[model samples]
Target: MSLISTSSPSSKTLPILRGQHLHLWFDHEKTKALDDMNYAISENEFVAITGPSGCGKSSLLNLLGTLEIPTGGTLFFRNQNYHDIQDLALFRRQHIGFIFQSFHLIPTLSALDNILVPTLGNSQQKKDVTERALDLLNMLNLGGRSNHFPSQLSGGERQRVAIARALINQPDILLADEPTGSLDSINAQQVLDILCEIKQQQSLTIVMVTHDPAVALRADREVRMRDGKALDMTQVLT
Candidate 1:
């Protein structure tokens, strides 16, 4: 990964993420998944990406989350050019948190263990991290289910566990891909409410990709994509 540090042109606002001319492609694929995309997300903002299948919503999220490098162009996180740095792994561990539709909880581990998984290796305040995880779980109404394994919990409960895990590290940004997918309508709304609440309570910056219109509506701004390009964009109050 590259690392270049520079403040945004408008320092009055906190631009936590910025991407310029981003183009990404898979090997042997002639078409680019993300083509010359440019966007910026400010601190404590909730931005949502919406589009039909294969519109590159997830791909864009991956790039912003630093899970993948752009084939061409640049990504800046906290005023640092991410591609300039080589320590991509450390960068992800320290600055990014991820949530997914599948929950991605370790099937073998209990809810508590799943929340503690990311903090297992690499350095952090262990006691504080563990306590924070528990606190998050409690806040999500999962306190009584701490020792329950993923298989034993309801779908909504498991996703709650995933959310708790993602926030354990107090990451600079949160990237969620279809976080409410694979759940019933009621459960999906509950998870969405929790996400909005977390963003408000912690002043967290979140970028989420969702196919659901209601879920997308919760964000402060929405970017629509089609054929690997951002189409129309708009902002709405949460």
Candidate 2:
């Protein structure tokens, strides 16, 4: 199904992200990771992509994050076609952040260092980047654990560190794949609360993939996928 925009025509802003008839194939086109999927996300919206295993949840997230190129169809970022973007890597760094189920933190690096990893080799001054990283750590409530490595932190702390790293670049969009899948109930809820708070505070557009209905309900809207296609997209009733 095409996930058409429901916004009023009087609105001037365009969707921050949109996918039109997107397809991603594997195994010589035998495996359709995404088949004619259509989706859109507005600025500052929190969207959850929910489906069972192998239903292309992660694939869709990858496409949105520019980590994977679609084999067919087109994607747009605020009306700019993906194919027109000359530098995918730079585009991702400037506009997108990613969180994963595994936390994806560097075990050997301190929390502050991990948060600063994305700023490496960039034109941003070292002093400024360090200041931003420290600020993010403090914002995420890790003010006292800047020196702690991933190995030394608890599951929730590690996830918060990952979140800080993702936000270090000040991205406009956050693509999270099963962000709370690895945590227990309490930690999962805490992480979800953090995401919601960050979204409101930073005006970030979040696209999260998960199989948990409870988690999906936490989002502003839920897009249900099946057989690599979006079956339904509806706003969650508060």
Per-candidate Cα lDDT values, in order, are 0.85, 0.89
Query: How well does candidate 2 score on lDDT at residue 175?
Result: 92
What clash pairs does model 2 have? none
lDDT over C-alpha atoms for residue 123 of model 2: 98
Q: Enumerate clash totals for all models, in the order shown.
A: 9, 0
Q: After superposition, how far is residue 26 of candidate 2 from its true place, in Å?
A: 0.3
RMSD of each: 4.2, 4.5
Give the per-residue lDDT of model 1 (tens digit) for 1-238: 5585554466437488887788999875686899878788888889888889988888998898777778999888866899787788777777889999999999999999899987887577878887888899889999899999999999999999999988887887899999988899999999989989989998889999999999888888888888887885333112
lDDT for each residue of candidate 2 in 151-227, tens digit (9 for 90 to 100) = 89999999999999899899999999999999999999999999999999999999999878999889988888899
